[model samples]
Target: MLAVALRHLLLLCLCVPATPPLLAESAAPPAEPLSERQRDQIDAAASYALATTLFASSDLPAALHAFERAWRWDPGEDQLLDRIVPLAVSLGRADEAIRYALIRAGDGSVSPEMLRRLALFASESEQWDEAKRLYELWLQSTPESSNAFERAMVRIELGRLYRRQGNAAEASACLAKIQKKLLAAPNSKASRQIITGLGGSLSQVYEMFGKCHLEAGELHLAAEAFSQARDELETDAAANYWLALLELERSQPLDAYAHLQQYFAAPGDPLGAAPYELLRKVLVKINDREHWPAELSRLREQHPDSLYGLQAEAETLAAAGKADDAAPLLRRLIDDALSEAAPIDEDSFAACGVWLLRHYAATGEANRVIPLVSQLGKVHPSLDPYANVIKAAISDNAFAAQVNARLRLVADQPQTNPAELLPAAYLALTAGEIDLATSIAERSLADDKNVEGDDLLSFAVGLLLADQGEAGAGLIRRALEQGAVDEESPAAWYYLSAGLRGVDDTEAVNAARRAAELAPASPEFAANVARVLQAAGQTQAAADEFAAVLRRFESDPDPSTRATLRETRLSYSYLLLQDDRVDDAVEQLQQVLDEFPSDPGASNDLSYLWSDRGLHLQRALRLAETAVAAEPDNPAYLDSRGWGLFKLGRFDEARDNLAAAVNATDEADPEILNHLAYSHLALGDRGAALRDWRRALSLIDDAQQGLLRAEIEQRLQDLARQAGVGEAPEKNPH
Candidate 1:
């Protein structure tokens, strides 16, 4: 028996024969058939050995030739075809491999191993139908074979073939069979090898199954399949990741988050970083609901190395208003990212810095934003507008001066951005340098002519020009013609009105009226329009306009606008008092004080009205003192306080406050100086009083000039008569 076995094995090896005598040029004899004994001796071993030797010798083309010869000689020897198929593939001979693979594919003599080799070759050559047909034949023929391992592998390949052919139902049937086979197989090396060899990746199978189910629109089934396959996978990362993705597609974020948490928990899991990122997004979507903090905290604790963890923690802190805590964490992240030897990505760093800066500003801790700004300057110096704006806003005088010097250096460079001129205009305006402001504003406007309708810098320049008098009228006309003006623009109209009022033009008053009509809701516009009406010598119209302004802006939330409305109404009321409408004037002033109790201007004006009427002397004194306390540096408020005290017969106190007001003035304001002169005269200091009244006369405009000149002339004559110097040449009051 041993001798027969050895002879049969030897003949099996020789049955393939040598290279067919190199296809000799001379006529060759026909090939002889193998005897029945020799054919019976042919087994898997001899075929495998011959194929291995030819393949190992690096004679791939000859090896495939030998494998084919061996397969043809013993047609039942499916093992030889198996050896031939891969060898043909290794030699890039797809056509030859397909020929041998088809012959043994459905033969019971063909082993599961041979079917796998054939399927692989067919798949590599993109012979999807042939590969599927071969795998299906092997699967059907070996349904009960002990080669469950090979059977499982063939099923997986079959599944892949069907998947590629877009036959989802057939593909799912093949994969489902393989999954059942794998579940039934014993947990041994062979079974494990089969599991591993099914494309050598369990995740791939699940991914395939997932795709099959998804394309069929069986999402729940897909999720369940993916979930089961993922559980079988030792790594579980990919499985968990796919499962999470499936849940996300279903809009079940909470379930997705749960899967992501598990994925993040596995150490060295391939999907650790990716799952943590998905978890963060999921958490953010439902963060406004309950239990968000727990989810965010879990992510932070579990995946400290993940950037998404740090981002989640930062977002959590910011949402809770704990910006102080978020800043240090963000700084550490930035430092670690930048310290790496690799080049930093500017876009990523800028996005992080922008978030941090916005949070810092929100918390009102502008000083804490310097580090982020400094880092941004290093990485993206060219596009650092927000950084520059923040730096300019947070710094005081000394720091502002230093920043300005540095900005000047940057601006002087030839490659400086023209957009930098906008901030330069703002800095100049804030520094009270009008010429520099004008130059920067003009440059900014020229560079960026698409300036928005309500640009604040343009409005500031127009207002500054208007405050300087008639020299600003041409500038206002140019601004109006530049298409920068809009009907609803309050500042434009204010400037237009002031320019017209300076030249005493009624056309400007009409334009102001149009502006008021456009922005009737704006308190500032109404107040300016009332002032214009008063300037146009329409007192009754002015009073009615002031009343309209107070009513319109009664619900306004802005403190500054509210203060202006109160002050304007009080001034109109005082005008009424001058016109001997005492009852109406007192009612308006009382209403002003009642409406804006914290406004020092309203309080002082009301007090002045009261004292001028001589009805509420004690109450007026208290109100005036309160006004001075609120705005001690305001000379107008101080003068009102002093006048109130003078009316109350506290002449000494009145003199001290009035003198302080007078000395505080850089340019002599006629009304303030006149009040000081009146207080001094009431205190019996005639010389000092005379000196102040004369100074007041020199500072008045044409309207106030007439009144001041008359007062000073009368005071000078009284002083001359008291000193016995005779009336000093009666100077014309007009």
Candidate 2:
């Protein structure tokens, strides 16, 4: 009878109940009144059954509570005690996990797995002493049945914990232990299986050693360690990637390239686009850009169905100006991925769709783009609003009726997401249907509960970008009145400042000042105040404010904060130059370059400045090249590079880059156009120069670009005199 009872107890502890315990109790009740111990046992069993059910149903918190209840009712069930800690730990119930784990530890028979879990939990919670003690205990208690790799992983965790606590000596001690274990680990198939199966790779062990050496500034030792990590498992992608990075840091591009190629070719899940980007960096460093096309073709041929291959092919097609060839491949890729029963490769599908959309948008093929937009929304529903905006923005007058019908479809649905209505409003605004646009905007904001401050601000910014500032300002005011965001928040005031800048200068300045007051330490808010002051014609005040903000962030410890400061200085310099403070602007830009020599934005701006002034033409060209390399598709960077080349008398190169810049920009900037015109004139294409200059002149705002407008006018007169034609013969810029 005793043996049967013990077996039954064990069975109940091991098995998770599928049927409700209440149902079982009702079916078979005790004949007589139960004793306290018997009642407790029955209650414990019931609670355990409930807990397991909750766990299976994915109600973790409720499961944890029920598990705790079971433990409280019957503490003698040790197997039952085992279930609580893991559940508690998973649910982030730190106190509960620790309490139960300590109870098991007190028994001096806790399993090594439980001890390791406790150690990791302690480490994550930042309980330095507790974590170290638990880790040390785990290392000591690791069963002889456990492999060396498992023991080494425990030591590595201890080493990482020590590093987190800034105890370098203790960390080194842990690393030494791991290294000894690694050296002794057998190179047999069983040993490798144990290591890999247990999720502890020999490569990972060496990688940790490399990291320790690297952190200690022992570069040579770090390199050797990383090399050993790569050699330990020739197929290890992580080891190759780390070694490649180290080689790059050591200025060994050729070595990095070999390792990167091995990493790229390693069998694994597709590495996506990052490896290709890194490969490009190495190729650029070696000045072997001519090999790029061949390398891309080889990669594509080797892995035709992989993301890496597809990305390489896309870049190849784009570079060769073969969008027509790329279009079918991209469409097929997206179609195949979507039609598959397996999980889709979302990033690859989206990239293909974006490429197709961009090609259509550029070519003004609204009919083609609209269908693609619909297809994209199936895979990425979050992009629906954005896709709609793109559809509307690219559509011509011929597509206006189609766009209006889509808007009407959305408008008829009373409970549709308000975000869906914004594209229609934008479309109407662009189509010059002001009344319809206003009505759509009203409908978008009809449900205040559905709209938030971010939505309002985003739509306002969009409208502002589309040159409907009055409508944008109205939305901003409505958001403020509705208290969509906290009135006291700096962000609200900042939004107000931006929304009202051109509409109401005084209000904008006041709102900017309020934001600055609320967030005195925020460089962005402070910078905005300066910009607002400048826009309001308080030039001296703005300059003083800029100086103050610059001084404040000059000694900031955080690298990101300092980067923001550099951006602020860049903005200040641009504003100063606009106000004709040439010497001040130059000083500010020079200071920014001195502080951040390799910053792409600063490099591009300063390079453009120098080229415009015909100063340091060669140096400007170098800086411009750096910016272009960093962001190849950036129109502004391309314009800067073109201007630099033009200043250096490289007319052919300048013309190519300027033409690329013109193609890249969605709506052409007058300054970029003027630069392109300069390149044309330098190349002796007088007719082309006149045409571009006229286009630039038409785009320039007399209110904001008085100097540029005057320069274009003077250039037109000069060209007229040269051609012996009356006022340079007006031609339609379109």
**lDDT for each of the candidates?**
0.63, 0.71
Query: On residues 1-734, what C-alpha lDDT tens digit does candidate 2 reach at each position?
Result: 22333455677578765688777655654347655466566666777778889999998766776776665556677776677777766665554565567666645466677777777777776777777777777777766567766776677778777777777666766776556544565575545654675476667767877777566555675686688787877777877776777787788999999988888787643446667767777888999977877887777676666654665667667778898887776776666666762233567666677677667656656556435544665555435335555555546555555555555655667865565565455555555565566566667667666555565566566666666666766776776777664567787678778778788999889989999999988888988899888888887788888888988866553445656777778878877887888888876776565444456887898788888887656667878887899999999999999988887778899889999999998888998888888778877788898899899988988899988888888887878786885444322121
Instruction: Check candidate 2 and list the clashing pairs.
Output: none
**What is the clash count for each candidate, in the order shown?**
0, 0
TM-score of each prediction: 0.38, 0.40
lDDT of 2 at 510: 94
* Model 1 Cα lDDT, one tens digit per residue, 459-554: 355445537444344445555566554545666666667767847758667867877777877777778888888888887888888887876765
Model 1, position 686: C-alpha lDDT score = 69
* Model 2 misplaced stretches (Cα beyond 4 Å): 1-487, 535-540, 666-701, 704-734
Top of the candidates by lDDT: 2
